[model samples]
Target: MEDEKNRTGPLMIALQYNDLFDLDSISASTNTEDALPKGRAVAFVKAVQTVNERLVEQNKSESLLFEVILIAKECSEEIKMKIVESVKYYGLEIGKFFFFKKEELINTLQSNKVKLFLSTDRDDVCEALHTGIPAALLYEQSDDHVLSQLKVIFSGDVIGFSEDSLDSLSDFGFSETQIETLKAAKICMKEFAVLIGQMKRRFGQENSPLCICVLTAWGSTNVCVSALKTLREWGLDVDEAFCLAGAPCSPILAVIKPHIIWDGGLHNMRDLSAHS
Candidate 1:
């Protein structure tokens, strides 16, 4: 990629994708990149995620980072010949930080040039980026349930169960502390939504630029869901809320959604809660 492609925004690094489901798009091959038997969705998603980490490390610089994936696996298998070229992304970052280390990660992205990184070794990639070198990683996103949850959260969509209230969502796996923060944020989100509504009435209907809170982890679902509903009811484009959350059960939590996806920052939630 060119130096300009690596440029950055005031608080964001640029991310570019060559293919939505193209594996060859990335230099890393079969072993490193996630491969799919019937769907290129996994590979495409992995490449996009790798690009995200790089963007975080690049931060506001004039550097643009491009992450590509090889997605023609199934087509090749069918015809017994390769048909390269396919990739996609939900590009853009800095909507919200729900995870603690994410700030550290973003801090790393701001100064260094992380060329690419994979989502599979998320913890490991994050560790390597500490050196301030442009890097890359790959990952795949599947599992409809988790993806659904992520999609809803990233889109700022409300996750409402048929039950009026969840007796316990421990199946999602979250620490007690995270749950508490989600609860408080949930209540606050209701008020926040009302303010957002008033903003819409004053400014007219357009959410190109809006401040939002993100919640990560199942522990955060209660408050996060409440907040989302409130925003929708009050009339803020909640899908544009740009909140954050961190629960590492599934690979692609919120990315499948339309909103700008963020890695949730639960441990980091303290700083935000303290301020509130």
Candidate 2:
């Protein structure tokens, strides 16, 4: 009884349905090997329900509450409804089963209710980890291993799991040429980190926050945006935000005054008052 009391509670699992089930060519007439079958979907739902039932039978429901969240992106509402109905048939309560779109995912994952995130998308896993959520990747190899890995995520042993190479630009839906352009224009994370450190050291205590001018091409826009979010996260007050057209030699410039500037791209920390 004491050992049972010390056991970990049930994990709240957020499953990205697109990863677990194939939706590449889901259509009424298109029944290919890659298409997710209705029978398989039902079986998956029932398997999860069985786990919950076993916990309840052992009187461990209070210690652990198994919940499943389904996230569907680029799928029709009809598909979403069908999936939801299938899960409901397996005795999954309305509150325990949730469906969300790509846009709604961040907020849902940030919620304290979700304990672990499971996805096949590398970007999704990264997003979850960035927001301080534990995430695991679902592969088609083995169900037993995947289930065990989910528990590992809940235990906080693994923060993110993805075997795929991460192409941020591509994952964000940029075309092949655009991805190459973005890769060339984008500032590396190390450079961004250094810039953030410089900001914290320089204008971190200024009465008026420093204004940032982000000048970059369209392909590198995400880099600038991520930089802004990172700045805010560091508790720095960003006075103004501007996106300039054309790619400047320097990706990020700090406008200390009308004339004074700090160039992050060059790592130039000198007072530019002489040039002004």
Candidate 3:
């Protein structure tokens, strides 16, 4: 009974689906090199297998859970078969797999005892961290060093490493321009929050309906138009909307109390609102 009290919980690993198979083909199809290269893939497989083998040697194999997450929207049957074959080659079972579209990875993380997410995509790592899961990058140069880092991360002795950190943002493939835009977005978001707070105070209610104003920068006219269409479809009332194109920025900035000020990336906003 005393030994049981000192035992650690099961270890659950969530691997990126594309990382298990041939990365070259997957990259060509997706137009992204965020897939694990052959050498790195073999190394990761060996590392996981080695850990599990050690567990088995110590009579602790029962405390391991492995899973793969399908981040791609569609994969060919042949490609999938190859993935299965590769997992089999590593002696890892293929029964534990989930499609991102069908299920949220956060759900699995919440239910598991100990969770670690591995992926070549920085966006995936960011998402996992956002949901409070420990994640590691499976880069082309991954080796024993990366594996050792994972062990340290899973041990819960680390903190202050977040998606917003410079290293993490860079790993997620954010360019300097993109990072600047995000910083601006954060300031704008805070402004929106303040505006919303003032509106609530004036209305004397927490659920006051807000009049949102959306403006697009010069190159984002098409995105704003799509957002308008989606907003109309959703029956959301928009007080004002416009594309900056050739217009002076001063006029748009002069607007004092728009509850929510959305600028650029309207297409993504539209899709998110539609789904919600």
Alpha-carbon runs more than 4 Å astray in model 1: 1-9, 14-108, 112-121, 124-217, 225-237, 240-260, 265-276
lDDT of 3 at 129: 51
Top candidate when judged by lDDT against the true structure: 3
lDDT of each: 0.33, 0.40, 0.41
How do the predictions measure up, each by TM-score? 0.27, 0.42, 0.41
Highest TM-score against the true fold, candidate: 2
Clashes of 2: 1
lDDT of 2 by residue, 105-148 (tens): 87877673565565545566655544545553332332332221
Candidate 1 accuracy as lDDT:
0.33
**Where is model 3 poorest over a 10-residue stretch in terms of lDDT?**
149-158
Model 3 TM: 0.41
| Tens-place lDDT digits, model 1, residues 41-127 | 443343334444534454545233333322111232422222221111223222221112333544444443323322333443334
Descending-lDDT candidate ranking: 3, 2, 1
* Cα shift from native, residue 178, model 3 (Å): 15
